[model samples]
Target: MESFSGPDATTSDDGPPPPSPRARSAEARRDAILTAAATAFVEHGYGATSVDDIAERLGVSKPTLYYHVGGKQELLGASFTLALDAYSDAVEDEAVSGVTGRERLHQVVQKYVEITTTVHGRCLHRVPDVELTPEVRDRLRAVKRKVDARIRDLLREGVRDGSLRSADIRMSTFAISGAMNSIAQWYAPSGKLSPEEIAERLWDSFAEGLRPR
Candidate 1:
């Protein structure tokens, strides 16, 4: 088993600080705000959704919404960032550590699918990038590229370990990622297939092609 280290998004001084009870509570509220904002954006389109709309949906004053997650643009950026971080973290999960390359890749695909079928995940892919400022769009792209690179690394490792057949890494990465991203556009919770079931089926399809010949 090999360990993969990518870019670190956070910086620490001396070490990481522990969260206070108030800070933890604040973070939870912020998460709820982001979720509401994403849900609004998905239902009304990012361009059509306003900070006021998000506030109304959450039954909070504009000031409280601003305090928790800032304005509309800030909320949108934060929502997309949260989704991307989830993708990056999926690959870094401790449970996948010490597993075969193919197994690690499988877990990653499963988690990616699970996240894609979520509210925040839908916003990440469905929201128009034109709604974001150029700077915010670039930042999100960088995070996404980092994630794609990590997936390619897993593919390389799998081939080296003889668990998967050799193939075009970049194309395969795009195919796998594109499929996962598209799920956010069409997946319905009320549909026959649950998120877990979708993940299992998608992984099985990818796995057959990836398995060693």
Candidate 2:
């Protein structure tokens, strides 16, 4: 089976000092803040959710919050980053290390589904141009476009191997993406379905239609 390494562990640590006890605490706090912020962003519109709202959610003072992410825009941007990282972690995985295009793409869909259902995924999808600074908006768009490209590339690879049907790559992407993104709108954690089950079901449904006729 193929294995993928994340950016942090993918490299050997250089000469940097081990994080101090304070640094570790700070890191943990930052993660907590980001998680809280992402949840707030998903629950409330990015424009409507204030820094104070996130601080309140985490039960931290504004100064403590600022120490982690600085402000709302940064928090919003970081939430998007969290989503992107999830994508890379999933799509980049070895996926039983399949060599065929369809095999690999199925794994991508599965992982993407699993990732999207989480807090990070919703944050990734929910951010909007109206709420973000122009620069941040553009940055998030770039990240999203890159994700789209990754999907297209996998599809094209599949087609080349005769494992996938030939289709309009761009429209195909929109169709698949629209279906996947809708998961966030209606999914419930309390529902009987688990993330793995949902991802597998989605892959089964999508794979049948996506194959060459």
In terms of TM-score, which candidate is strongest? Answer: 1
Model 2 bad stretches (over 4 Å): 1-18, 88-96
Q: How big is the positional error of residue 125 in model 1, measured in Å on the Cα after superposition? A: 0.6
How many residue pairs of model 2 clash at the backbone? 0
User: Per-residue CA lDDT of candidate 1, range 28-136, in tens?
Assistant: 8898999999999988898888888898998999999877778898899899888877876777656356467798888888888988888988998899888887877
Each model's lDDT comes to 0.83, 0.77
Looking at model 1, residue 116 earns an lDDT score of: 88
* TM-scores for candidates 1 onward, in order: 0.83, 0.82
In each prediction, how many residue pairs overlap at the backbone (N, C-alpha, C within less than 3 A)? 0, 0
